[model samples]
Target: GGPRPLPGQEVSVKVLGALEDGGLGERDPRLIFVPGHGDVVQALELGVPTMQPGEVSFFLAAFPYAYGRPGREPDVPPEAPLLFEVTLLEVRDGPDPQSLPPAVRLRLGSQRRERGNFHFARGDFAAALRSYRLSLRALDGPATAPPGPEEEEELREQRVKCLNNCAAAELKLGRAEEALAACEAALRISPDNGRALLRRGQLLAEQGRDAEAALVLRRALELDPASKVIHTELSRLAKRQSPPS
Candidate 1:
């Protein structure tokens, strides 16, 4: 009850109320933990720094600080205000990825990769690239001997996937050279990776290196013969190379 919780500190609290439906009828006893750096809903974020442990208070958050224009449907209405009856329970230092256990770090890396894929599916290539880079960063650690065989293999596979994803995102962003570099990195990890080979081939074709693209595409086809997209690209390249008819 002395030093107030800071912005970059993790805090646990009990929140009693909903932003919509006027508010909860019962005091919600369930505890909620806010992460460091306040990467949370704006209401809790703005209110947390003002709380002292064990102190209970109610705060009304305006729509701008709550759900905004497009609110969370079926719960919070558009431009709805939020009322929170909060009781701060505990405070602690937030997570530091470098200080986490290896298993946790690996999971975080995988989570980042999944987030990248989500962004990529939404056609947000810049966000996808950021997430892919973060995934690799999560896997980065002190340079040392290889890990145990199981973890080593897992890491190798994860890095290869991350690099391949980065290549795809870069290609979408029209960064052919960067895409090629990422594909090269992925291929270094798994030379026969069909996706990486396909990406590299596409980048080569885009750069007008038709011969190199054909060679790479052939290798990719050897790995993934059923890929119609790759087959289409090969046909396009062939037509481009054919003499005037």
Candidate 2:
């Protein structure tokens, strides 16, 4: 047998959750996560580490350890506890964000980003933001091995994408200041990121920082001269800046 699933390692498992009445709660035939990385519920994170590969186990996770007070809504009731059945399928060592090579980190980050996109498309902005932030965490950590140039570029591009998504989700959640910070962070990573530029400009204009918004929007326009969305935003900004009659 290989090493037991440990903190900072990636584990693949099948998991099912049920109410005490034998009613189904939640189930995933293929669930993958890294323990101690907030990838799964606290119970799984704490319990899976003690399991050997190919083992099936059950654990009772109180509300705090499972879905917490709000309890995942609709499926899991508020403050309701769940019984979890978990199968520890495989565990890989040192998929740790801090210790993974750039390539591995990129792949993990991409997976999380895709999950964020899935949630966003479903109008679950909070869930989408959580996944996007996780993707950023996976992408931002220091690499264990030195990265080649192409890998570095790939990593940077992914980071910019996640940050832009974070900004969009933040705005959707009405956290404009957080959204602005996310946009700035993306622009710092890649100054030519048009999505970041457009979002930042919109945030600035909304906050009445007209000159700053104008500058940012102009740069975004330079980057994507044919973007109808950018042009619309620019026109709206112009109307706001015009002296009220």
Candidate 3:
């Protein structure tokens, strides 16, 4: 270990066993990469700091350092004491999350948005909403300096899209109030956003506010005249408002 592994570095290691009496049983060594600051088993975190590369050490870790109560189940039992024979392989630097370049951050946000779209297509609205929120967080840059006009506009557009997606997910979950807020936030960014307007109108109609829905839907149609979905919604609202002969 030329230099001890520092926080935020990536460490490669081999774990020999777990718990007293080698609870993991006799088996080939297991290799894993642990990001120094990443989520990891507590025992490894405690043990790695003291060991140098190519040094093998045995340590007994109590439940707190192991899986603790309500353990991983079918793997580690509740309140199990763990034993580890560890070998540190190598340490490498990890990227500073805050210092990522703007372009890289935007690309990451796009990836998250794509994941959200995949979840949405699969009808997993909850996961889709989480991914959309994560995308927004990724687009939200560090506060050292404000993004320039072009970058600001790009971020704004991404935020609006994520907000619109969030609204769609919320609507599918029967969370009309949350959906309304998301769509409203998106419209504030892009006032003529037809999708946001359409979602807002749909939510209002679902809540039995047909008149308000009709007004919003009309505005949406103005923004997107070719939207057959908006046209159909308007027709349905009109028919409901019409008195039967």
Best prediction by TM-score: 2
State the lDDT of candidate 2 residue by residue for 44-133, as single tens digits.
Answer: 878999999999999998987877676666788777788999998888865457688787888889998987886676566887898888
* lDDT for 113 (candidate 2): 94
Sort by TM-score, best first. Answer: 2, 1, 3
Cα error, candidate 2, residue 113 (Å): 0.9
In terms of TM-score, which candidate is stronger, 2 or 3? 2
Off by over 4 Å in 2: 1-11, 15-31, 35-85, 89-95
Worst 10 residues of 3 by lDDT: 32-41
Query: Can you write out model 1's per-residue Cα lDDT over 1-245, one digit (the tens) per residue?
Result: 76788655778878765655765522546555444322234567778778888998887877766555665566667777878888888888766666666676678789878867866765668868988887787676643344576876787889899998998899899888998999999998899998899889988998999999999999999888999989988999999999998
Worst 10 residues of 2 by lDDT: 33-42
lDDT for 24 in candidate 3 is 89
- Per-model TM-score, in order, reads 0.66, 0.70, 0.59
lDDT on C-alpha atoms for all candidate structures: 0.77, 0.85, 0.76
lDDT of 2: 0.85
Expressed as tens digits, the lDDT of each residue in 151-224 for candidate 3 is 77888898899999998889789898999999999998899888899999988998899999999999999888
Candidate 3 lDDT score at position 66: 60
- For candidate 3, the per-residue lDDT at 211 reads 91
Highest lDDT: give the candidate number: 2
